[model samples]
Target: MTEVTEAGVSKAGVDEAKAAMREIFPETPLQMNEHLSRRYGADIWLKREDLSPVRSYKIRGAFNFFRKAIAAGAKDRTFVCASAGNHAQGFAFVCRHFEVPGVVFMPVTTPQQKIDKTRMFGGKFITIRLIGDIFDQCYAAARKHVEETGGMMVPPFDDRDIIEGQATVAAEIVDQLPEGVIPDLVILPVGGGGLSSGTTGYLKDVVAPENFIFTEPEGAPSLKKSLLAGEPITLAKLDNFVDGAAVARIGDLNFAALKTFSADQVMLMPENAICVTITEMLNVEGVVLEPAGALSITVLEALGREKLAGKTVVCVVSGGNFDFERLPDVKERAMRYAGVKKYFILRLPQRPGALRDFLNLLGPDDDIARFEYLKKSARNFGSILIGIETANPENFAGLVERFETAGLGYEDITENEILANLVI
Candidate 1:
């Protein structure tokens, strides 16, 4: 198999994408962000692909795939795809736009919000099948359906046309920049690498940045692992917290363009740490971002102060299809990462004034967020789950010291998922 390099992502393909895309939606806005510029000490611009029709860049690739397939005289009028999230919504929207019949298979565990959005986009042009509890199962079912019914299977991120289509974003970035405005760095969030590969390849051909920083959720660092091993490797398990970017493996087609970049360029950020960025953007900047959307922002702290100062940087805020129902979980993770809250399992004495004694040990700034008695293991002591939130992070250390000095037997369950998910 011949390898495709960054140079191989042709400008002709991007031009074709631009021509084809205008039939669907106009180019997304690329605007300079004032808030981020002051915070990062750089001229920061956001290529607002999140403002796309499907609230993501996913639609661009999906639309391009179907258009090219139809032009190639793919006689199968029906298209089949498996995705529970953005891709499904993208595929649905494009299928409706083209008046092509589509069957989208999604995991049974997919949220109703996603399902409804996909339906709303596709309207009469698509039929949805809730097949399996997991994406692998749904993907398998969709492939089987394609084989049996002669429908074309539109993969989410692993195709040449998809890569070409996504590259249009890079073209827009280049075209939209002010005169003599060249980015020092471009930070991209990688899932299967369609967007990253496309953007990087196109920019390298036109106006390559001084550096590229590819970020992935630590729970799903497919690109980092692939670059390290010199081949794509499937993860044994994936934390679906960053569901939009939690891919098990980088797509082979996407990795082809991305292969030239050194593994050192890729950064892996913790999933919980990303929530802190998400919450901060929502509350402070009023920019509501999904977990995957906040990937570039979360890596800034680890990038050191000097690397980011006085440089023009572009951070791709990938998608904004956040489900508000998960806000509590996001808040909890943010609080924990910020060191504002902690959970402890305490063996409080069963005697009178015991609770009052423990309460007095807390600093004036510390407030109890959760308290529950497990059971009286003995007549003298009882196991209690205690959660404390403090105004200042330093207060937690002081509070812990007071507990130790008071001879209270306690275990911090904040970082223990087995105990936390069960009790807290």
Candidate 2:
């Protein structure tokens, strides 16, 4: 296959892709987010890809891939893909729309919510196979099946056609904006780099490349690390919390499209900070965003109000296939990041007055969210796991001062990932 050049993703190609996309679904809304705009002191517009049919921009690529393949007179009618997230759902939805047979491979440990949704979208047009314990293993199995069966493989990213299809998002953004107004910045969240690369490619043709900013999860800084190294580098480990954007390596075609950019163009967003954005969006704007979908909005903090003031910014809200089961975890992480909640291991004396003394130390705004005895059988002292939520972070300092004054023994384990994971 020929390399995807900057010239390859031309205005005409993107326009064609957009026109083809109109047959499937209407353009996602590009709404001026009043809350975010007021907070940042900028005109912040959100391209709501989360509102897409599959709750993501993945459908655009999947649909375009299928449309182009069939149009090319390819004999292989069967399609196969491996994904445990939005891609699988998008591919399945496209398969149903195109009326083509599809085989989707997902890890055995894939959540039932995602599996059921994929099945629901594909209906009778697709068959899902739960194969491996991990994504790499599932992907390998999918490749082997396609190799043996002579079926077409719909890669999550890395293909020119897929990139072209994803570029339609940029086309829509440009067309949807009010006439005579150009955005000063466009924030894109990068995973395998399909969305970022495609959107940046098209936007560069119409606008300046300097106007683009790419974001990736801090734990999975694939594009940022690759750009810094001047080559694609696979990460040894990735925090899959941002499941939709935690790519170990940027796709080859995607990197090719983005290679000329400097590392400073990409911002690494902390997973916890993203949770804060998710919670804020949910509570303030009544918008539910998955971790990946929240990346663009979360990075606005890193951008700073000084730089963003009076600028017209567009944030691509990538996906909203959030599992509500993770809401508690999200809330906990958000609180911790906001400094309003913390966990501590308290060594309480085995006496009746000790519990009351510790309780009295808490400020009026402080509340104990969790209390559990770890080593209750101890003769002198008992190990107590305590979770505290406070209105202000300064309340913790006062409580800690009280602990010192009272000679109470305690260890704050709020920021200790290992200990918190084991107990909290």
Candidate 3:
């Protein structure tokens, strides 16, 4: 591995980024979070990137990229990009700020809410191209457009300027802390490694944080895998539940700064566990965080109460580009993570008393969330899909015990992805 001596972004880069980005949007807040501090036994603070003009930190990178591009005699150029969420929105806003013509390509499946917000932000400065069902397809279409039209392409997170821009967040974090005060730990969300790589690069020389935890969706551990193998690797499949932080491969340049960290520092957070954090922040803190934004907080459970007790920690709340349409899915995942929901496929006899026998097994706190007869055998058997929700997760264990005692044939489908995709 080539050891790059952090010629990359840093505190100095943040100052440069700030001067350049001031034309776009002001710095986001790095505020103390009382609620989290009290719960985790730490002096916790939140870098509220979610409060930026675009409700994300993407604007910093986009602005810096555009500024550098324009300075290099590209003012007459049209900019293009592909993104379905916060990045695209930031690009549009930056295009509008510079009064430059830009085109944004997004997946066809992107929610209307995001599409509308992007349009509103860009106004007449940008054009929206809905091209493919998936991100890679849209990305290809955008690159082709840029190639054919002689326009500049603004990558979401891979560019040098983008990393420098994101490093500005670290500047805000340092400035917000009192003199002679440095956090013992810093938790950051890793998607394509732009934000994490940028922030860590900046902080490395200034402060040797006692610990650094990188939170990636379990479905996408690109950084962890890349560091383990000594090179970037593409994931064959990626679950988009944590859409904002789900990346198939960490960016080459971003990983250059990131590979210095050990694999243990990268924490893989479950998608469902993230939902719990999202809901908690929304309901308790009245802070609406998208899945990616909640990544740091969600991994707190793994830190264990003992390690976190009486320490100064900072968690970056990445973005708040959440679509309310996903609320049902988020709630369902939260319920499952909290151990209040389960799904099962029950094999039933054709006898009239079979349904009654199963009903008698459920505890008083158990409620049938879903029930459907999925299959039937002509004379003797049937297949039923059942979903149970309870006051607590332990209730399902008792329900399972009763099913076994009664000699019932059943399959727990709660964690079955293939079966879940078919019906759930």
Give lDDT tens digits, candidate 1, residues 1-424: 5434463557777777878899999998888888777877888888887789898999989989988888898635799999999999999999988888999999999999999999999999999999989999999999999999988999888887888888888888888899888888889999999999888878884445438899999899899999899988999989889999999999998887788789999999988899998898898878878899889888876785577889888888889999999999999998998899999989988889999999889888889989888998788999998889999899988988999999999999889988788886
Which regions of candidate 1 are displaced past 4 Å?
1-8, 206-210
lDDT of 3 at 278: 88
For candidate 2, give the lDDT: 0.92
- Model 1, residue 318: C-alpha shift (Å): 0.8
Which tens-of-lDDT digit does each residue in 72-109 have in candidate 2? 97535789999999999999999999888999999999
lDDT for model 1, please.
0.88
- Model 1 Cα RMSD, Å? 2.1
The sequence of per-residue lDDT tens digits that candidate 3 reaches over residues 1-424 is 4322252654665677777777666678778888888888788888999999999889888988988899898989999999999999999998888899999999999998899999999999999999999999999999999989999999989888898888888878887888888888899999998888788877876667337889999999899989899999999889898989999999999888877789889999999999998888989999999999999988777787688898888899999888888888899999988989988988999998989988999999999999999988556989999989999888888999999999999999888889887987
Please provide TM-scores, in order, for all candidate models, with all chains considered together: 0.96, 0.97, 0.94
The predicted structure with the larger lDDT, 2 or 3, is 2
Q: What's the distance in Å from true for residue 350, model 2?
A: 1.1
- Lowest-sum lDDT 10-residue window in model 2: 1-10
Candidate 2 stretches with Cα past 4 Å from truth are 1-7, 376-378
Candidate 3, number of clashes: 0
